[model samples]
Target: MSSTQVLNHSPFRLEGDFISQLLTNIRTRSISWTSFVKAGCLSNENMSVLKSITSVNDQEDPLSRVDVLIKDIPTYSKVLFDSILELSNNNTKNLDLTKILLVILYDGLTYINSELFESTITDEFFKISKGNPYPPFIEILNSTTSNSNNDDENNQDNFIISILTAHILTSLLTTVPAQQPASSLDLVSLLFKYIQINLITSNKLQYRFLGIQLLKELLSIKSFRNIYISHTEYLDSLINIMLDKNIELQMRYLSIYCLWTLTFDSKTSQLLTTNAKYSEIIPSMFKFANDAVKEKVVRLSISILINFLNTSINSTNKNEIIKKFLLTNGLTIIKNLIERKWSDDELKEDLNSLYELLNDSIKSLTNFDEYENEIKTKHLLWSPCHKNTEFWYDNIDKFKENNWKLLKSLVSLLSDSSIGDSNLTQLYINQSIICYDLSMIIKVAPEVIKIINTMGTKTQIMTLMNSPNSNVKYEALRTTQLLVANSL
Candidate 1:
């Protein structure tokens, strides 16, 4: 059959018939195939089987043909890779040929043994040309539109190529060495960009799932994980995918699974707990676990939260993470999850462990611990401690601990500009509460005015004093009056 005839069939038909035709053509004329056979990479029996399949209609079992090819997958992958490069370099937009080559490569890799896979695919496949911004595969990926209509052949072809490429690359990374040279970094960046454009942004569930799967694979390497965490935009994109209510349950589960893998590294866990943008992961996981209908989704989300809570480098960091979880009503979520009957005994065990951890955290917290937690989380509000006069009196001296750690956090919150719009009322309440607490601190211990002044807390309060909101303006005015009255 002509390549065009092969291209015209359905994908399932294409898989068997198309591969049979391509292998026959390669065996007869391809230099890569000639070299592999000359090197005796394939046994005589396998070679005889390959030699027999000259026609697409050959009655050889498809699994038998696959077994023969997988035994020498490196040679087959190289041949397919060269074909793809040639087609791409010629600017041949034969979507059928490209998709077929990618599908064969993808399937070959999928079926190959792990040992052979690791040995066959390496950094050489991932190299980028210094003259060109993207590798050829990436160029094709960028050239395609992500139209969702299946009737659009070109778009569908592009989508298939993308998914296959993602799967193929993920498999290739299994044996590809980590900490590659700087030249290959462009490929990493381009791959991430492609995923963001095609997979993460695509409406198709298959695309999103493969995208996250590819992400998980990329993150398996330490170097790639570092690069990933350094780019907060991508990190935020990942978190958004996990939190998207419109996303399917499996996709969300995969996204959290990616996170669960990431938190295995201490530095990543630290960033998740500390970075304002990434820290939203805590609340997102809690909410997902609370609402997820699938047992595995809830299990994975809780596992991630537990990782965050347990992976802290210090007690202060641990406490801050625990406090953030509790502030988001994580305790309530955990309790509820504990009440549900889970088929997985491990999940039930995890729920019980998480509930105990949160309870222990709560039991150990003094009023001051609660107040400090609120300050550190930048989520201040009129909890009882904020309104209690005696609480402030007792804790005013403790703010000096850790060189005024709690006080510094409060000042930092006062200066923050990126507080999101979704919580505008809460923002107002938080700022108002901070102002009230600062005034009470000034009243209880006038000496803290020096520390507050040096940190420019006064200026931020003055800015708040001009607010149009009556409560914020009033609280800011009250705090400013105290600062002035207590001035040294």
Candidate 2:
């Protein structure tokens, strides 16, 4: 699993009505605001049932819980959301109030319904669609007065504002439907400007990750993608980070995912292929694909190339760009990548898809006459394996290499708990593809089978054979058949 995937899914749902209830209960019972605010929602034992309700994973009762939260939360109306928003902006500069308000707004907005958001919440939180709603917090952050004793508190305040702002932006992107006018490109740009200034520009790595997290979310929406159509600065920043080896691994991976997101737009793709600076860095991305540390980055790097190729399919200058890509050794790189041991069938599918695209394009460009000659001469052979082997020798063998290290890398991936089960499924599917490919390769080159056995590859293959997924089992069986057939 990639860094982008890990951060995209929200771990907990925040209930608006529950928030309102806590405030109302505090007021009715004459509790002190400071004490209640300090206690926070987590400290209330009496609200355990409500907390439990919120704790129930949406996956367990998707229709019931999610629907109820969406429908019931709006009944409290904008009063709760507005109150929290106003408190966050209050001039008193009480750190406690700011903290509590930030907590409420961040949690509630993260999971609110879009219709509710557009109709009742936008004006209050954003001060009419065109205004800067975060000035007060930003003032505190930009202030030069740094007390040595309170430095930790000040840092905490900045971190809260950063996280809270990101969650607000993410909630808007999440709830606002693509067709709604509230999700205007201008509004997205305004919020992104804050993100760029406050989070992306910060020297702190935490702020960079948070900013990129919001970038990943916004680009998930097609309407929001228009914000980057003419604006290449975001693309430039993400690329710079991806190329920086000094940054944390997660930050670099998120940058790669952000670039992948932009490829969905033609303008971004055009800039990448036609723009001088971007075009220069295109080859370096392929090197990142072959990096030994993580398979996800390699998968993402190839996926980015695929997007670039897809974008070039129709352009008048398609051949020119294709020639550039080939000069970068794109064909040889992908062929060797395919030979790498994979833990996910989907990634293998991606590798195959890229190979197919590259192969078909190259054939269209170079083999038009050969194809015609084959038809005229009726020279095609009936044997499947023989022709396939010959094709590998002619085109693929020039890049031919063993993947003993790929096997070791994949085995290490099985123990990774960082990525969710969905990613694990992809890893399983990828392993299946590698097994199937190895089986076919062993048929033509029997010598490689000894290498596979020596690497203790059979143990891993048998483990895949026992997998519950039918697709994985079928591939495992086919691989076993090839291995046994060669030995006999």
Candidate 3:
């Protein structure tokens, strides 16, 4: 059995309510303001402010008092901030209060005096040491734990505090200049982990929603775009969320919104064109735009597609992207979208622009260009040109260019094992198309058979002859027969 299968049967698996139960247990515990004052973590005046906010007799909402504290006595923000740092240092005895203090800090920072608080918080929160690469709050998050049940509880408490601290830092980072923190640390990876842990690992919808919101906010910062673009794993994670059928509609919309934000950067847009892995996003966006019932989701999907075309670094990249789009029937989808009565003017404008762009691309694309792009993308289908005798006769020699680059791509596609069982139909179609194309090439130029056999294309074709799909087996047999006849 695989390691994943073993892990699935592990006895120490987390319960569905793990985070919920942790929060409930933490909330049941309380801390007195007097303890903080005595420890010098909170000044007497700061303690007074806390008392007023938590006062039982006060008719006003505590949040209102928090707003007043930050506005009238901006120094109180520092007092609360300092108390949090101090309490976090002795976290074993003060974890509960540190969480409460972090809540207050998050609220206060929303109305923070940028002149007084920005530089100070930025320096303190991101302060690094030779011993540790993470910030202090992230240090708490990285704390190690064993399998002991008691230690698990302690670890859970630390995790709760770390998440709260991350939120507070997020609030501060959004308001201040993001470049300093972004450059100082691997902020992209850190934020990606934050989102992944909450959204993917946890079962709670609220946490998942909050994760998407955090991603949206961070992507709004331009400094982080290049770093984000470089990590295909990060992009893949967001794309999975956006494409997941089980995810909430709003969450998926927000996830795509994050992708839209990244496309505003030219480098990310170009990466989508050149990288095969990232290029898969083009078809996904097209399908989502075609199927989504929500106007906002459709609007954002179209907007991202427009950005991809507009931001393409050069004509080659632009045409590559456009070909992928067309392979997914993007032009038909755009035409239907343009005919709809969209209430959003911006959506209408985007639809028209995308329509024109796709039309222009269609005018410039040759039959061979489309065929070559399909091979490059490895997304084979029986397009009209695939069976056209004229197309095969005209383009058979073109595949030999660049030292038979197109034929090599075909061989690679036939050899791919990554297509999962769920896509058996697609796998069969792709295999059939490749076998038929190889047979056509062998018939047109028998001399290329020596080259094709050396490239192991025959081995892949012979394997496909055992497939359950009749079409695949038939095409594979026909191709193998051609190879045999030509070799003799």
Candidate 4:
């Protein structure tokens, strides 16, 4: 049948005969069939199957077919789900059929009322997860093929099914009431069992990534972390993966987020910092901070370190941790990052926050000048050979080129005095220097004010309007006027 004919029929009129034809096509492997049925079209059976299949097939856009079905005919979703589950369970060796069911199930499960489905099959789901094949849900549906030749296909099928199953299970658990116990078998435990099995043992990065991604989702569930924290291995796996330089960069990036979530809990935070096995994880994170090649990875690593610094621990313990962070050359690295200008606009605030935190941590243990002066020497802020520096030296002609770099560096240092025991005189002096640089850039640069405004140095400059120093105050007022006038 043509798609036009299918699409033209009214929803109320599209049931009996058309459904039988569609089912017949599906059973007979018809080229145009979008779904299947096992027997004669009893009116109710045909209606249920027809509604779902037609919902999927009549829509011109395949991408949105299932979404329409869920939104418009949600009451019929279970009927659609039951048909696939029954077909797959009834015929085990048909890999082709199983794959078809998987795709349909993936779509439906993604948008269906998960709590309704979970309640109906909670016991069966728990039973399915209990044995040799890790994803028992798929195993119960498919009997093993005896031929050894299809092992590769079977393994591939199993991996996809396993990942799909994890997603389905996680979704189902979403609507479960907080007061209700997950299942006869704990759903979180089942999830972690598979996560650890796949994450720690698999050599493949894809599998490991899938496992970490699942863990990230689980972190959204209120009680999921309590279960996760109980199992030390889960925590260990995350830290180890994050620190392993040999692992894929994306995988390591995901692990950093997962670890960051764990640090929210006091117990998890202590475990991460105090665990002997994870000694290298924290240090390696600082190393990541020093390397700006991967902007996201560096930012996330720095964020996790900030969380550690914010984690509540005894003063002596905190000092020891700071000392460990210092040993990683964290102080030097933060200094280096502060000196180099970043091109990505998104990274500017995050980079500033990292520098501020590391600098604060250092000062808490000792004086600020020792680290502050050392950081200043690293930046070529005063160099006459501007071409040799990162930005704003020789490009007297290109205000676009030099203006941003000069502004960021000035703001970075200006923010330095804002962090700790402020020397007003030093800050005024610092503010005077930055305002001087700002005034000079405005004279030569065309688009510079917007960048300065967008970079958020404008507000800091506005604060300087009240400065005690007349030169600093005059420069601040002039810079503010220029920025506001440029915007208009």
Candidate 5:
């Protein structure tokens, strides 16, 4: 335990007070001067000499040393495991005792890697993400094959890196562990249980991503459908996490994605219609879709709408929710993205998601007509932002400003999915008519009207009034005018 003992021993030295000291310090939010280059020298085999002092007997528990490491960091076992990774990688190209050590070390590391394979540090993961730099598997596929000289013979480690988690479980089937069908559903049940017990209810971000990625994989399975469906309240807990609070973009991004996956879930979608617990969660799905940086959110919105539409096709509750989404003219917003003149990478990606959604929406409208009491939705004629522009007036801000005009262009383009749907009038009426069907509660729903009226102000409102597809702005203007008109 002395400094001489620590310095004189090889990486195989056990009871090196050096590592034991630094780990004790890390918990206080300060890292010690001891480095990975220094710590990488400790040997797991030598550490096996550690003992349980409570026994007072002359015997030692073989795992007592490693147990101390894990007990000290039950929350961040991954960080402890990482020390082994640094050591193994340093000796990967050594081709001698080092290679032998790397091989022996690989099996235990593999086991640790497998068990924690798809787990996460929840939302704080984004902080870990920005500090630690590593590209995802898909990005690596587009580049060269060899990423490192580690256990992989042909850059297979590159293939193993997942954006969701660096998942590495497999059966030599070339399929990642979680993707191999119902067999991995146990993985689903297990991870969700850990997440529910820990990260789901926490204010912390660490390990929050583990839950997000695991749930995402679960949804991909048809068998685990009931698992998520029955846990409606828990899923809602996951959904309602506030976005602005998450400083980590990727974690926030994954949380939004998890909600999207939940809403699109067939059973989860049906349950929301009947379960009182989920009505808030179900409608709130639009929060992500309505945000400013919304390509991921919009795509998920389309999925939520599609699931809701399909559930409606089979049952009821179509009017209460479906009508708002369809009329929010969110569909038209995406369509315009596709038809617009811009050709940037970000725009193209967003446009692709928009097209895919419109494609699915058209399919739903076409195929769901067999149901009774089907309220026919219409085609879209996006009224440009100017006109009798009265809605703009209520929205506030200068119409002449370039930013205001640019906002109009971004949401108004037509998409590929918009190309063939013939019910333009029906879709337009759905937004203009059904959405405002809340006309009776306009006084009570001031917040609703304010959100709808956010884009422009009074002068623009007059411009929107005389605008070509003026009905929406006009209807809104008439509704506002009617309150005082009726008061007199």
Candidate 6:
């Protein structure tokens, strides 16, 4: 019933080989150079079957027909994955190539066998890896422009390059082993550089489509999210393009996708507020998503707000409400160290470090003294229920419930990550948490006294303040005096 569960089911639904065959067929025709491409493996018998269903010519409808053929793909490639990339390099100039690439990247993802997916077909289209001449798709597109007239070729060149880049990225997502960060990081880095340079310099409506491709690819990595944050300028271009009237919906959707990736990175959360352009830009997100762009942009905005909320320790009351909703809904990931799968001590040790980190994070959050009261009351959040809520105190129970669950989720992450820690390490980690807690208590103690009138006068306090550690007591006394003076 949840949105992710519902959304995930469809993407992973198609059969592996069937999807592969579709991808292969598309690739074969995608290249304008390849006259050798066949109708499809089953085209001889199914030619009539395919023709009746599609209303256009063989070339025009291949991409669209393939889309239809895929609903039943599970029947074919659910056994026949080899067929996906079997198409030759001729798939170079296909106009609708972008469509098929997205289809494979989206649907074929679920069925791909990691070993076969990676070893057989990954760089075949782009030819990037040196071992096999897996040159990137960019090179392939650039090659097309060589023999063409400059005037006529420009738009088509932009189209082909953008489409190819999109497909290349789609292939990466569809095939890359989701679990391996180390193997994937290098390619992701290369992709970020490609997208940044190509999309930024061109400013062409069609070229902006690469923004979506890059966003989807980068998000899949999850580990190298930092790379996204460091490149703030590229991100600004996306926010700007999202609103450009001349920009196509294709590119706008792509820009929206890019915005969602920005949400996952912590650094950019602040950039949304600190960067002057973002003040108005961020608000416009609500208007941008309607029935059309709604699912992508709306979910993206929620995800972005959650990132900002998660990073805030002393954020306003409204922040608490937002953070609470996100946590309750399982939007944030709590790091965990589940050991059911393996007994390796090394693995356990790594998990322990992860646990320590969770504790440190939780403690930091617990002790967060907070933010300005006025701002807490002023900032507003749009609610999925209807109009956005202007005041969080109006929904205190929801906030408290979410806060409680947030702590519980931290416990889960810690438990999952605690596999290797010996008692000593855990004890040491716990000590750090205790120290952090002391700091938190120290921060709020004076405020507590001011509210309760619990503190005695300084002279009365000094009479009883005989301590071995005079310096410690002196500091405490000085702190209390400052609190009292400020209260007055």
Best by TM-score: 3
What C-alpha lDDT, on a 0 to 100 scale, does residue 134 get in candidate 2? 40
- The number of clashing residue pairs in each candidate reads 0, 8, 0, 1, 48, 28
Report the alpha-carbon TM-score of model 1 versus the true structure.
Answer: 0.66
Report the Cα lDDT for residue 108, model 5.
23
lDDT of each: 0.66, 0.56, 0.67, 0.56, 0.40, 0.41
- Of the two candidates 2 and 3, the one with more favorable TM-score, higher being better, is 3
Task: Give residue 296's lDDT in candidate 2 (0 to 100).
Answer: 85
Model 5 segments more than 4 A misplaced: 1-187, 207-210, 217-219, 242-247, 273-287, 292-294, 313-321, 326-488
> Tens digits of per-residue lDDT for model 4 on 1-488?
23321223221111234323432333333222233333321235734554454445444332344444444343444444444445444544444444444444444444333343333223333333331112334343223322223346576555545566565556445434343443513756867877787545567765676777777777766577888889887777777677676876666777877777777786776766666446566767777767637777776777777667677577766666666566456778777776777666655666577566556776554322222222233221232322223233444344354545535655676656442252456555566666666666665664677778788888988988998789779878887887777778
Better of 2 and 3 by lDDT: 3
Cα lDDT tens digits for candidate 5, 1-488: 22321122221111224323322232222222223234544445332321121122211321222223223232343332333334334533221222222222222222222222344222122234332212221222222223444475744322222211222211111123333434345444544554565446646555355445445555554555566667756776676553435545555666666666666565666666555334344434455445436465556654665567665645346544443444344566556555645435654665566456545655454111211112222233234322323444433333225644522432232111342263455434433542233243344334334433564332333343443556756764665564334445
Candidates ranked, most accurate by TM-score first: 3, 1, 4, 2, 6, 5
Measured on C-alpha atoms, candidate 6 has an lDDT of 0.41
* Candidate 3: tens digits of C-alpha lDDT, residues 1-488: 12221122211111136444554354334448798677656678767866554443332323454445534443554456555545546634455566666545543444334444334333444342222223555544443211113346655555566555555545545645533433444755676676675454456666666667667767777776666677777777777677677877777888899999998988878776677666468887888888889988898888888898889888887777787787678999999888877899999988888888788888776888778767666678798988887888898778888988878877787756665343667678889998898888877888789888788778878888999889999999999999888778
Where's the lowest-lDDT run of ten residues in candidate 1?
Answer: 5-14
Q: Give the clashing pairs for model 3.
A: none
Off by more than 4 A, model 2: 1-79, 108-159, 292-295, 313-316, 343-346, 356-488
* Runs off by more than 4 Å, candidate 3: 1-48, 56-76, 91-93, 107-151, 178-209, 420-424
Clashes of 6: 28
TM-scores for candidates 1 onward, in order: 0.66, 0.52, 0.78, 0.53, 0.37, 0.40
